[model samples]
Target: MIKKFLFSTLIALCSISAVNAQSKVKETNKLEDPDNLASQYFSQVMGVAVDATSNLKLYKFIYEWIGTPYRFGGNTQKGIDCSAFTKAIYDKVFNTTILRNSRDIFSMVNPLPKDELKEGDLVFFKIKSRSITHIGIYLGDNRFAHASSSRGVVISNLNEPYYSRYFYKGGRILDSVKDELIEE
Candidate 1:
């Protein structure tokens, strides 16, 4: 009986030690994760280049400005149109210029199937006439971000009847190397 008690105690102590070691390892891992530090750095860089990041936030801000008013050839928080919105966003973010309109933007970016689309990618629509008519920023989960004339900055699902019918091509910008992108 004494031997059994000693063995049981030994096992208990070993299990306790193992649990403590695992807890320490988890804490160490939390500190070592690069994603944790990179997010802080990304916030600083994004602020400095607020006008030049990527597709999503630029369009996100544009969507916020929707219903401010639409003016011909205007580009500002006060007023903007389809082409103007697209041009202004790309110009501000990444400091690159996009093709003037829906058709041009559709043609400029690399073509990728809708199934392969991800966040910050461009979704083009073929409305009215063919040749691409509207553009939105893909938000993943089959939803996209865009500045609707009526709803302003909003997320729309691709499954929606209107969007599903007009959906055509998705544009993925492969310009930046993976190492070049600040993933945080």
Candidate 2:
């Protein structure tokens, strides 16, 4: 009878310790996860509650490419142009390949009114010229990320006077290309 009671007590104690250890591990994981941090950062940036799973992949790519410097014809991480940045992002995040220049990409998709823009859409600008010279990936909530000649890779509000004035049209991925853009 005494041995049975002692065994029961030992099992209860071990189970309690296991539960406590699991709780601590979970807390540690939450703190250590880069995705968790990225999600929190994006939530703060967007000023809205971001769904971690739905948008985490997109945010991860943005976070990884943040601060890449701008180069007029550059296409790699060392230095990338606005359209190249958009192309790289689409290729990496959505598994979509797009044209290298802003004009070609702008022509590929159907135009959407500003009010109709959605995440993953492309935003074009006629910066410093009459034709489409710049492009960015729309990130919802009036924010877009691009490789700015002056600022490198950065997120900016579309409502900024400079962007607003230069804004041409927003483009959704073409239906033909949609089949090519496998979700990563």
Candidate 3:
């Protein structure tokens, strides 16, 4: 009788240990899923639904540079200007190179109306100047990512009073230019 009781206790302990191990494996798999983690992180950052972060590459690039400080002509994480940030995104995410200044970059695109703007499009601003002095990458839902002189790298809405006041135009890269870049 004593031997049977001891054997029964050992079996129960083993069963409990196996169950706990399985539970941990399930939790680890959930945490390791890159798509799920990216969706959750960007959704919270952009203040949008999880499904809205469908372009994981764009969002991931933006996430990595989100809080970088603004510096005129700067191009790295230590400091980056609007045009530099825009160029970086295109270079890394789209695998294309864009002009380094706002006005010149404007020439590479076909001007788009705000209502027709799409993800990965360029949004230009006159700011305090008459020319295109600032630029940002459109991120859908009226939000854009840019390196602001006052706020460093951030996402802002087109409807914001400050942005609307100086909004210049939206643009998409010309198909010819895209093709040329790809060929090179």
| Model 1: colliding residue pairs | 51-92, 51-93, 52-93, 52-94
> What TM-score do all the candidates reach, one by one?
0.58, 0.74, 0.80
Lowest summed lDDT over 10 consecutive residues: which window, candidate 3? 46-55
Q: How would you encode candidate 2's per-residue C-alpha lDDT over 60-84 as one tens digit per residue?
A: 7877888988889998889988988
Please give, for residues 1-184, the per-residue lDDT of candidate 1 as tens digits: 9999999999999999999999999988865765544433433433221222334445445445545565555566666565676666566665665667777677667888889986667888877665777787775668775655665444578889998998898987556533234452
User: Which stretches in model 1 have alpha-carbon errors above 4 Å?
Assistant: 1-74, 92-95, 174-184
After superposing candidate 2 on the true structure, give the runs of residues whose Cα lies further than 4 Å from its correct spot.
1-37, 45-49, 180-184
Return model 1's CA RMSD, one decimal: 8.2
lDDT of 3 by residue, 78-120 (tens): 9999999999999999988999999999999999989999889
Candidate number with greatest lDDT: 3
Residue 27 lDDT, candidate 2, scale 0-100: 90
2 or 3: which has the higher lDDT? 3
What local distance difference test score does each model get? 0.65, 0.85, 0.92
Model 3 misplacement above 4 A: 1-33, 49-53
Query: What is the C-alpha local distance difference test score of candidate 1?
Result: 0.65
